[model samples]
Target: MCNQTTTAEKSSPTHIYFDSPEKHCRGTDYLCCSISDIISEAKSLFNLAFPIALTGLILYSRSIVSMLFLGYLGDIELAAGSLAIAFANITGYSVLSGLALGMDPLCSQAFGAQRHKLLSLTLHRYVVFLLFTSIFISFLWINMFNIMVYLQQDHNITRIGQRYLLFSLLDLFTNSFVHPIRIYLRAQGITRPVALASFFGTFLHLPISFVLVSHFNFGVSGVAASASISNFFVLISLVAYIWVSGIHEPTWEKPSFECLTGWKSLLKLAVPSCVLVCLEWWWYEIMIVMCGLLVNPKALVASMGILIQTTSLLYVFPSSLGFAVSTRVGNELGANRPYKARLSVAVAMFISAIMGLSALTFATALRDKWALMFTSDTQILRLTSVALPILGLCELGNCPQTVGCGVLRGSARPSTAANVNLGAFYLVGMPVAVGSVFYIGIGFSGLWLGLLSAQVCCAGLMLYVVESTDWEQQAKRARMLTCIDIRQPDDFDCNKGEVEQPLTCSA
Candidate 1:
C-alpha cells in the first residue's frame, strides 16, 4: 500500500511527554492563572528570545560568511552558492518551513490544555506528514537544478548553485525534524532544550566551517559540508534531549488514532500558514531576480542582500515573541478564555514593538559602520547607509506583523493571514514598489518602500483581525487545532442566509 495516511487512518505516534488528552478541562478561571506565573513565563520567554535571535544570526551569518569564504575558491562557486540558496529557499526551504511554524501553535494549545493524551498522537503523525513533505522537497532540489539553469541564471552560477543545493538539501532533516522537536519542547514549557540545541548547533557550525573551508580545501563544498554536519549534530542533540527525557519510543506501548485525527486539525491552521510564507518568499525571489538586472547590479543585489539579511537577523527577536504569543494565546483559547488571549497578544505585540524600535535604533546608529561588521564595499556601504534607515522603518511595520500572524495562527485562522499577506505584498505593496524602484528612479529605495508599505498593510490587517477575533469562536475552533487545512463549508442553502461572511479560512 502507498504510505499516504488519511485523516481517519492516521494514528498519533506515542512519545514520552504526551499527557493523556482526555483530561483536558474546560472553563477555568483563566484570569486567576497567576500574574506571577505570567511574569515568570514572560521572563523565561525573554531568555529564549535572544538565544533564538542569536541562532538566527549565527545561521544567517554563516551563510553570508560561507559565501564570502567560498568566493576565494572562485566566482563560479560564489555565484553558484548564491543561486542555489535563493532557489531552494524559495521553492524548498521556505515552502516547507510554513508547516514547521504551523506545528508551534498546535503544540502550544496542546501544552496549555495539559493534554498529554493527544501529544504523541499529534506530533507522531505530524512527523510522518512532514517526512513525506521533506522527501518530496528533497527530490525537488535534486531534480530541479537543470530547470534552474533553464530559468536563465548564469552557467557558472548554476553549476555552483547545484553543488550547494546538494549540500543544502540535507536540511530536510533539520527543517522537518528539528522545528517540531523544538516547538514541542517549548509547548512543554521547556525552553532550555531548544535553546541548548541551537547553541550546540551554532557552536558546532564554527569549527566545521573553519575546518572544511580552510583546512580541507573543500571550498564552497566545505561550507555546505559544515551546514550538513551542523544540522546532523543539531538533530542528534534534540533527539537525545527527547530520548533522555523519556519521550520517544522507549515508553510507548502503542499509538492512538486520536492524534492522527488531530493532524487534520493542525492543518486547518498549517496550510494557510504555509501559503502566507510561500507568498512572501515567492515575491522576494522575484524581487531578487529583478534587482539583479539593474545598473551596478552586483552592488544592488549585494547591498540589498545585506540589508534584507540584517532585517531577517533582527527579526529573530520579534519572531520569537510571535511564537511565544501564539503558544500563549492558543493555550488560553483552548482553555476557553478568549479575552485573555486578546490581552496576551496585546502585551506580546507591545514588547515586540519595543524590541523592533531598539533594533531600528541600533541599525540607524551603526548605519555608517556597515563597512565594518556587515560588509566592506565602500559603494555598498554608501548605498546601504542611504537605504538602512528606510529598512529601519521597515522593521517598525514588520514587528507587529510577525506577532499578528502568530495571533491568527493561534485562532486556527491562517487564511485570514494568507489573504492579508496576499493583499499587502502583492496587490498593494509590490506594484507601487517595483514602479517606484524602476520608474521613479530612486533605485532600491522603491523596493524598500514597497516592502515597508506591505509590512504596514499586513500590520493593519493583523491588528484588525485580532481586534475582531471572537475568542468564543476561537475557543471552539481550538478543538480542531492540529491539522494543516483551513477550509470550512458554511451552511447556506442555495446562498441566502442573509449572513454575509468575511473571507473564511484556517491555515
Candidate 2:
C-alpha cells in the first residue's frame, strides 16, 4: 500500500508538498491550526482591514459633508437632498458598486495565480460595462422629477430633489471608472494609495462644498456639483498615482478586442453580485420611501437620512473586514491553499464581532449626540435618537453577516449570497417592517426593528453556509476560474491531487 501511494504521488503533477511539518501546517486543512497560527492570521487580516476601513470612512464622509450642508440650508433642503441621494443610490451607485464587485474574486484570484493578463482584461471589461450602465442611470436621473411626482411625493420636495439628481449626473460617469479601478487595485493588495486619494478628495470636498453651497449659495445644485467635483478629483488622483508609481505595470494588460466580447462568464457573477448589493441597498432606500408614508414625512425622511449616514459611518469597519477577507480568501484559494482561505474567514468573523460590539456600544452611548452632527430640527433629532439604539442592534448582526458575504464572494458563490439576502431582507425583514410600522402602528422604531430581524437572519444563514463550505472544492473552482482561456469541467481530484485536461474557450 505504501509503495502504491508513493507511485500515485509521483504521477500526479498537481500534488502539493511541503518542505517541513511547519510548512505542512501552513498549507493543509484548518484542523491542524494552532493558537499561534490563529493569532498570526488575525494580525494579517487586520493589517489588510485597517486601511480599507479608513478609506471607506473617508470616502463616505463626502456624502456626510453634503448632508451637513443640506442640513444647514434648512429642513426642506435636507429632506430633499436625502431623498435625491437615496434615489441615486438605489438606481445608480449601488448598481455600479455591485457590478464592480463582481470583479473582486476574478481579480484577486488572477493576481494570486499570477495570471496578470486575466486580471487586466477583467478590469478593462468592467470599466466598459460600468460606463454603459451609467448611461442608463443618467436617463433615470433625468426623469427623477416625473417619477417622484408620479409616486405622489410633495411637489416642493420633488422639485428640489429633481434638481439635486440632475446636478449629480456627472458623478455617475466618474464613478464608472472609480469603482472598477478601486477593485482592480484592491485585488493586488494595494490599499493605502486608495485611502490617501480618498482623504485628499474628501478634504477638498469640504472647501468646494463650502464655496459652492455656503459662500456662493448655489443650494442643492452647488452641493451636487461639489460632490461630483470631489469624485472627479479622486479619480484623477488614483490615475496619477498609478502612472507615477507604475505599480500596475506588472499586472496591466493592453486593452484588447477580447474585452469587448466574452462577457458571458463575467455577467454570470456580476449579475448576482449586482442583485445582492441592490437587495441590501434598496432596502434602506425602501425604508426611506416608507418614511414618506408615515405622518409628517418631511421630518421622518430627514431623520431616516441622518440615520442612514450614521449606519454608513459604522459600516466602515465591517465593510473593510469584508473587503479584506474577500481578497485574502480569493488569493489563498487561487494559490490552492484552502486552509489559509478558511483561516482568513475565521479571523475576519472574530474581528467583525468585536467591531459590531463596539458599534453597538458607541451608538447607545451617544444616541443623543450623534444626530446633532447632521441636523438641528427638534422632531428629526428626537426621531433619530429613538432609532439609533435599534440601528446599533442591527449592526450586531450586520458585521458578521457582511464578512460572510465576502467569504462567499471570494469562493465564487455570489448566487448563494444573493439568495440569502433575498430571503433575509425581502421575505423576512420587509414583512416585519411593514407590519410593525403600518399594521401594528409601532411607529419609526419599528422600521429599524425589521432591519435588525433581517440582519440577524442573514448573519445566521451566512455563517451556516460558511461553516458548511467544502474548501477543497472551492480551491478547484479557483484554479479553473484563473485559467482564463480554459472552459471545462473542474475534474481535479482532491484526494489524489490529480488535475483534468483543460479545454479551449468556445468560440
Candidate 3:
C-alpha cells in the first residue's frame, strides 16, 4: 500500500486531474508536487526497481553458466544446448512468464484494497494454471527430437537437444511455483527476498553444475539437471523465507475448491499477456533464423548471438522498471489514489528514458570493446561493432515501450498492448526487415533496423494509450477486480456506474 492522506484531501478532485502545481488541496494533498515530492517518488520507484533488476541479472547469469559448461562439453553439445534453450524459452518460459503476469494487477490491487484473501486465491489459481500448462510443455519437449528432425536439424544436434530437454522437465513444474510466487511477493512490495533467494540459488548452481557435469560425468543431462535443481532451490528458498519471515501470514489463504474455478478473470488477462510476450520473444528467435539465411551466415549468426546477449543484458533495467511501475500503479489504483498511479507512470517513464539514453551512450562509446567481451574473431568483432549502435538505438525505444506495456498491464488493459505489439512487430517491423535485408541488401543490420522500427511504433502507441488513460476509470476497474465493497465517503465521489460488475469478482 501507499501513504494515506487525510479523508478531506482524498476527496479533492483537483489532484485526480493532475492539475498545475499551484492547485494544492488541504491537508498535504496537492494536485502538483514540489521538487522534493518528485524526488521522493523517484526514490521510491528506484528502491523497487533496483532489487528487481539485480534479481534479473543474477538469474540471467545462470544461463551463462549453463552455456559455459555446455561449451566445455564440446561444440555439438553447445550448439544443441543453445537450440534447446531457445526452444524452451519460446515454447515454455515465455508462456509461463506471461501467464504469471496476469496475477500482477490482481495481486497488487488486491493487496492495495486490503483484500488479502483475494491475493492468496489468485496466486493459487495461477500456480495451478501454470502447472497444468507445464504438463503440455513437457509433452512438447518429449517430442522435440521429432520436431527438430522434421525441421531438418542435424541428427546429432537434435538427439542432444532432445536429451537436454528431457532432463530439463523438472524446471517447468518448479518454475510453475517460482514465477507466481515471485510476482505474488513483488506485488506486495517485497523484492529483497526474491533477489536474495535468486542469488543463493545461482550461487549454488556453479558448484552443482560442476559436480554433475565434471564429478559425476552426467554430461548434457547434468547441465539440465543443474538448472532444474537451481530453480528448485530458488523456489524452496522463497517458500522457506516466507514461512520463517511470516510474510505470507497476512495473505495466505487455505486451499479451497474456489481456486479450481474462477478461470474467467485470470484467463481474460493471461491469454493476451501470453500472446504479447510470445510475439516479442519469438521475434528474436525469428531473427536468429533469419541471420542464418544471410550472406556469410556463420559470421552473421555469430554476431547476432553476441548482440542478442548484449541486448538481454541491457534489458534488465527497463524490464525491472516496468515491473516496478506496474506494481506501483496497480497498488495506487486499488487504493483509490489515481493521482499516485499517474505519478508512478510519469516518474517511471522519465527514469526509463534516462536509462535508455545512458544505454545508448554506453553502447555507442563501447561498441568496439563490447564485442571483445564475447569474441576475438575479427569478422564478428567488426560486425558486432557495426550492429552495437543500432542495438543501442533499439533500446532507446525499447525502454519506454517496455514501461508502457507495464502501465497497460497495471491498468488491466493488456489487450491493448497485445494488439500494439502485433501491429508494430508483425505488421510494420517484419515487412521492413524483409524489405531491408533481402530486397535492399542491408544485411544483418537490417534485422536490427527492423527491430528498431518495431520499438519506435510500439513506444509511440504505448505512450498514446498511457497518456490518454483515465486513471479514475482505471481505479474503478481496480475496485471491481478486487471485488471491494465500496462505501463512498461523504466528501468523495466514487464515480458510480463508471465500471460495471463492481462486486462480480466475488460472485
Candidate 4:
C-alpha cells in the first residue's frame, strides 16, 4: 500500500511520490489505476457520509419527537410549539450552527496539516464565542413573550411560545459546547462516536418526552425540557467517549488567551457563513409568514408546514454529503494534496446527484400520501399533493447546491457562496414568489415554483464556481489560514502574484 502511486501523486509534482515510467507508458495500466483511484475516493466519501447522515437524521428526529408530543396536547399547543421552535431556529439555532461552521476549514486543515494543538485552540476559541452568543440568545428567549406581544401575535400562542422557549434556554448553552466538539471530531475523521452519541440521545428523547408530557402532565414545557435534556445527554456522551477512547490525548490542550488573539480571521469566515445560511433559512421562514396572508390562511399555513417538515426531513442525506465533502476537501488541501481535494469534490457531487434523483422519484411516487403523515384535512392534502412534486424538483437543484456550498466553505471561499445566495434567493426568488402568488394568482403552487427557480439558479452558479476553482490556490490559502501562528500575520500574503510555501511548525 505504501508503494502504490495514486492519481493525486501522478498529477502533482509537489507530492513526494513517483510512478514507474514503464507503467505510465502502458495505456491499460494507467486506465486501471485511474479507475482504482476513483473507486477509492468514492468509498472514502461514502464512509464519511453514511454515519453523518444517520446522525443528522437522529438529531433532527429529536425535534420531530417534541412536535409529536405537542400534537397530542391539541392544535393550539402544537401550533405554539411549532412557532416557538421556528423562532428559535431562525433567531438562534441556525445562526449558531453557521457560525460554528467557520471552524470547519480551520479544524479540518489544521488536522490535515497535523497541527493538533492548533485544532485544540481553534475549538476553544469557538466554544467561547458560541457560549457568549448563547447568552444573548437566552436573553431573547427570556423576553419572547414581550417580543411577540409587541408584534401583536396571538395572545394564547405567545404565552405558550414563551413558556416553551423559557424551558429551552438550557439547550442554547449545551449546543454551544456540542457544535464545536462535534466539528472537532468530524475534522479529524472520527464521526462514528459522534453518530453513536446522537443515536442514544435521540433514542432517549421519545420516551422522556412521553413521560414528561403524557404521564407527568408537564405539557408543552415538558416537551421542550426533554429536548434540552437530550442535548445535554449528547454532549456528555460525546465528551466522555472522547476522553475514555483516548482520542484527545494528542490534541487536547489547556485553554489560554492565545485562543482570543485571532478573532479577525475567524470572523471573516464566520460572518459570511452566517449570512449564507441565514439568507437561505430566513427565506423559508419568510415564505411561511407570507402564507399567513393568503385566503384561508390556516389551511395554507398547515399545508406549508407539512411541506417544510417533509423537505427538512429529506435534507439530511444531501446535507450530510456536504459535510463529508467539506471535511475531505479541507483535509486534502491542508495536506497540500490539491488534486485529491478536487477528486473528492467530484465524487461528492456525483453522490449528491444520485441522492437528489432518488429523493425526486420517491417524493413524486408518494406525493398523495406524503401529507397524510401530518394531517387528514382534505384541503391540506390537496395542497400538499400538488406541492410535493414541485418540492421534489426543487431537490434536484438543492442537494447539489448544498454540496457545492460545502465545497466552497472547505476551500475557504464562503464569500462567493454568500453572494450567490443573496442574488438567487432575495433578488430573484422572492420577487418571483410574490408575483406568482399574488399577481399571477397561483397560490401555494407559485411559492414552490419560485423556490424551484431559486434552487436551480443557486445550483448552477455554485457548480460553475466549483468547476472553475483553482485548487492549488485553495491549498495555499488553507495553509496560510490554518498553519500559521495564532497572531494575525502582517507580511504573509496569499495572492495570485505571490504564493508562499506551506508553513512548517512543531505540533
Better of 3 and 4 by TM-score: 3
lDDT of 2: 0.85
Ten contiguous residues with the weakest lDDT in model 3? 8-17
Better of 1 and 4 by TM-score: 4
Query: Which candidate has the top score in lDDT?
Result: 2
In the range 1-507, model 1's lDDT, one tens digit per residue, is 001112333233321112232321122211222446447556755664655666666666656666566545654454456556667878787766787666665666765655554455556656667777888888778865677666655555566667777877678766677766666666665666666666688687878888888898777778887887887787888778877987554213245554445455557556887897888777666665566567765566556556656776778778878777777787777665665675576567768678878878978887888634544667777987887888788778888888888788777677888999999999988987888987888777788788888888888887777766566557656644432113344553222223322111122
Q: Write the per-residue lDDT of candidate 2 for residues 44-75, one digit (tens) a residue.
A: 78888889988998988888889989998989
Best-matching candidate per TM-score:
2
User: How well does each candidate superpose onto the true structure, as a TM-score?
Assistant: 0.81, 0.91, 0.89, 0.89
What's the TM for model 4? 0.89
Which pairs of residues collide in model 2?
Answer: none
Candidate 4 least-lDDT 10 residues = 9-18
Q: Tens digits of per-residue lDDT for model 3 on 1-507?
A: 233344532344443324565555344544455677678888888899999999999988987788778767865676567667767888998999999988888888888888888888888899999999999999999999888677665677669888899999999999999999998988999999999999999999999999999999999999999999998999899899989999989789887899998787679888988887888888886786676555665566556666777888889999999999999998989899977888788878888899899889989999999766555669878988999999899998899999999998887788899999999999999999999999999988899899999999988898878877777668878887776646645553333434464322643
Score candidate 4 by lDDT: 0.81
Candidate 4 global Cα RMSD: 5.1
The CA lDDT at 225 in model 2 is: 94
